[model samples]
Target: MGRSGPAACGQTVAYGLAVGVALAATVQAAKADPLQDPYGTWTLQAENDAVSTLKGTSDQYYTSGLRFGWTSGTNNQPPAISNLNSFIWGPGTQRIAIGLQQLIFTPRQTQVSQPAPGDRPYAGVLLATVNLISDTDVTRSVAGIQAGVLGSYAGGYQVQNGFHSLISDTPNRGWSHQLPNQPILEIDAGRTWRLPLITRYGISADVLPEVSGEAGDFRTYAQIGGTVRIGQGLDSDFGTPRITPGLDGTDAYKATRPFVWYAFAGADGQAVAYDATLQGSTFRSGEPHVSKIWDVGEFEGGAAVLWHGFRLSYTQTWQTNEFQNSKALFNFGSVALSAKF
Candidate 1:
């Protein structure tokens, strides 16, 4: 079994490489046509969304022994969640676009503390453990508009697959990081309204079609859902954090800027509405499987100066009312970098 694991990973890598090469070739061939997108971009990011410890009060420093809990019916500890999302944007000439995004997070820490003034003085001491395993989430998409619909109708397809456990408490025992053959398919269409206020508002609807595949004796299944992202570009830094572990006399290696910035963006560039599906399904493989849907709304802004091919940027994103399984609510902040070509 140990030997087979590496072999399977190698095959997966090979398959991904083949797909990437094919995509590059197709795009290059279409470059001669005006219908292709000229907006090419690649960004590397370092993101950290550390959750505040389970405390007794909002403004106090008290602690709790029962820090971790399951979500409603689920019976597993919550997994520490963080994401390193990377993507490329190409707005084709035909009013269409394509994007590829990958989100990965690993090296999680789970710690708990005992109550103080107990029978033992060391009872209040903190006991924490770190997990070295890594998880990856990847998505590849291709979308376009109908050439004869007056450019009002547009739709595209996307495929997503990954091995990240959805569990929040028991991060180590969540699920076997298997490359299930199941992949999701998504399609969306909408109409754009260019307002007189120099703003564009797009109203769109999305759908997901379920897909199934065979992976030996264990069958893989995938279901579809839809999400809408009302995005607006910003050009200012609104109280963004400028300090990080690397620059604060820590031994951490230097990483790419922890935020993405847009020179043409304005203060009113934050996204107002965002929602999605398929986030609430519990895995039934063997160990405890939990699925919780999430509806998230966020505000973001950034600013920076450009020199040569590189730009220094600072950004901040605040998420609120993040719901899972319609039961629990949580929120976190994320910082990332944006590199433009």
Candidate 2:
């Protein structure tokens, strides 16, 4: 949990090197259209269970993500509606996207001290996702689906602890670790409606309803929820707001205004049938044996702003406890920056 000045400097240098490599890759691939579309976007996002500061205990995790997206300019084929296409690849305004994500989880000192034989290990997950998003109206209405795989790597605990030491300014106290290594399949869909009356006052409102599910060693459950947003609406697609990065294609570039901003809030509930992290299995093992909590809920609020072609957003979320005997409620924050070309 503690970090030395030299270690912090090393982490910074490493991050800078990563950014340099990404920039170089972008330049090298500039001539090739990865998405085969004229319109494209790139987004970078970071999420952490620790908001303003890092803590050693409950719900300690960090995630970093990058996404690339593209939209088709013209509909060359007739719109088709099928379970696979509707969810995997929307029928209307065709769009496709890909994302890469890294997640790390750490245990609290309390848990480490009173380990349950073989529990409380540091874990890390790496994921890659492919998504499809579309808008029939090309503005207000939108839908999307995403699929991805999650994998675990060695030395995740050590690597993450080093980063945490830098953030919390505490030296790393090594601990035992076990993480799930599995492939996950996910699918979801949503629709958004713009409120007509609010538009007259330079403010806009919309409601979105969505449902999603995941299958793998990580989780096996289904989720459904709705969200309402009110803000300065620019012509764009209604993108689902979540801690994880995904596709959010829009026609905002075509808007008359050069800047756009908005504030949003939402609630979602989940029926957790199974969670590998809590209830260990043959594939993955962990401590503090847990019972399946069928009901879980979350509340979130956030704001976003877009100027020229760059967009920035921030959100704060409070989550209900996930397992029994869990005393603290989980809270986290997410920040994202994106640009359209």
Per-residue alpha-carbon lDDT of candidate 1 for residues 65-144, written as tens digits (9 for 90 to 100): 11110111111113321111111222221211222222221111112232111110110111111111111111122221
Q: What range of 10 consecutive residues in model 2 has the weakest lDDT sum?
A: 245-254
Report clash pairs, candidate 2: 1-170, 1-171, 1-172, 2-170, 2-171, 3-170, 121-177
lDDT of 2 by residue, 176-240 (tens): 43544555444444444332235656787766555555555556666666556776654443543
Residue-level error in angstroms, candidate 2, position 228: 2.0
Model 2 per-residue lDDT at 102: 61
Q: Which stretches of candidate 2 lie over 4 Å from their true place?
A: 1-37, 52-90, 110-121, 138-155, 165-168, 171-175, 180-197, 244-256, 281-289
Per-candidate TM-scores read 0.30, 0.68
Q: Which candidate's TM-score is highest?
A: 2
- Determine the C-alpha RMSD for candidate 1 after optimal superposition of all C-alphas: 23.1
What is the TM-score of candidate 2?
Answer: 0.68
